[model samples]
Target: MEHIYLLALVGGGLIGLSATLLLYTLGRIAGICGITFSLFMPQITDKKWRITFILGLVSGAFLIHLLTPIAIPAAPTDNIYLLIIAGLLVGFGTQLGNGCTSGHGICGIARKSPRSIIATITFMAIGFITVFVLRHIWGVI
Candidate 1:
């Protein structure tokens, strides 16, 4: 239990450090959605860094899984349709919120952006309600 907390603290600190570094070096928020969206835009001049950042994220996870004893959990649902719908909903939510949790909860909040703060609160509340409804009311997980 103590180890979990320590790992979380270290992970959070790394996230903050990365966000700060990105903001300081690139004058851009380390928003994953924004970075991903930039990839589809041929006109975006700075795709290289975005690609590298995304690659780092993927490779880092793989490296951690290989190096650490921690066992990464699989997806909760194996249904392709459910997965697709969930992905679509998440994408839509990100679009509507103008950012994902990491962007709003971490970088945006760190920068004291009111929109990000509100967005984070709203999503967190909704997420809590969703889990309650799914787990308790609907008896689904």
Candidate 2:
């Protein structure tokens, strides 16, 4: 648990630093969903930045694996149909929310946006309720 905490701290600091640097240098928000979505849009003129950003994300994770001994979590025990439905629900939620956890929780909240605060709270509460329903109420643990 202590190791997990330390790892999370390091990962979070890296994310925050990367977001700040991107914001300072590019005059843009470092929201991955926004960045990624922009890449697929027909109006995107310069694709290099988006490609590089995604590559950096993948390479950074690869570098972390090279430097650390983190183990991958086991595959979900839930049925594939259920997982697909959950994924679709999450995607819909993300679209409806206008941003994801990292976008709203990290960047938006950091900027002191009231909408982000509410969105983050709702996201977390829903997550907590889902876990409680799964593990306790539904006995799915």
Best by TM-score: 1
Tens digits of per-residue lDDT, candidate 1, 51-118, equal 99999999988888899997887858887886788799998889777899789989999989999999
For residues 29-140, could you state the per-residue lDDT of candidate 2 as single tens digits? 7777777777778998877887899899989988877887876567886688778878898777877788887789899999999999999999999999988998899986
What lDDT, from 0 to 1, does candidate 2 have? 0.85
Error of 1 at 139 (Å): 1.7
Q: What lDDT is obtained when candidate 1 is compared to the true structure?
A: 0.89
Q: TM-scores for all candidates?
A: 0.92, 0.87
Q: Identify the leading candidate in terms of lDDT.
A: 1
